[model samples]
Target: MKIIVNAEQRDVSGCTLAKALEELDFISTAIATALNGCFVPREQHAETTLSEGDRLEVLAPMQGG
Candidate 1:
């Protein structure tokens, strides 16, 4: 299926959010997920299903001294 990941268009065959993150090699929980402009909680990642044309945004938290 085709989905927009991190503001970029990519082709993937993942059925769930967890699968997509695994396919993309994302392992850290420091990043936030936004699906189609809605912020998705980290705990819900495993149950969220991804479909064609879905927009995903992975934002990493920044820390400064």
Candidate 2:
């Protein structure tokens, strides 16, 4: 399926958010995720299903501010 990840179009095979993240090589635990402009908690990642054309945003904490 085709979805938008951090504003970039990506093709993913996983149907769940967690699996997609794994396929995308996003193994870091220190990150935040949002699906289609809605915040998705860490625990829900495994259950959250993704559809084609969905917008996924992955953000990691940054320092130096």
Pick the lDDT winner: 2
In model 2, state the lDDT of residue 62: 88
Off by over 4 Å in 1: none
Candidate 2 error regions (>4 Å): none
**What lDDT does the true structure give each of the candidates?**
0.89, 0.97
Q: Please report the TM-score between candidate 1 and the true structure.
A: 0.88
lDDT (Cα, tens digit) per residue for candidate 1, span 1-65: 99999888988788988889879887788889999999989899999999899999988888998
Model 1 gets an lDDT of: 0.89
* Native-to-model Cα distance after best TM-score fit, residue 50 in candidate 2, in Å: 0.4
| Tens-digit per-residue lDDT, 1-65, candidate 2 | 99999999999999999999999998999989999999999999999999999999999998996
**Angstrom error at residue 50, model 1:** 0.8
Residue 12 in candidate 2 has what lDDT?
A: 100
- Index of the highest-TM-score prediction: 2
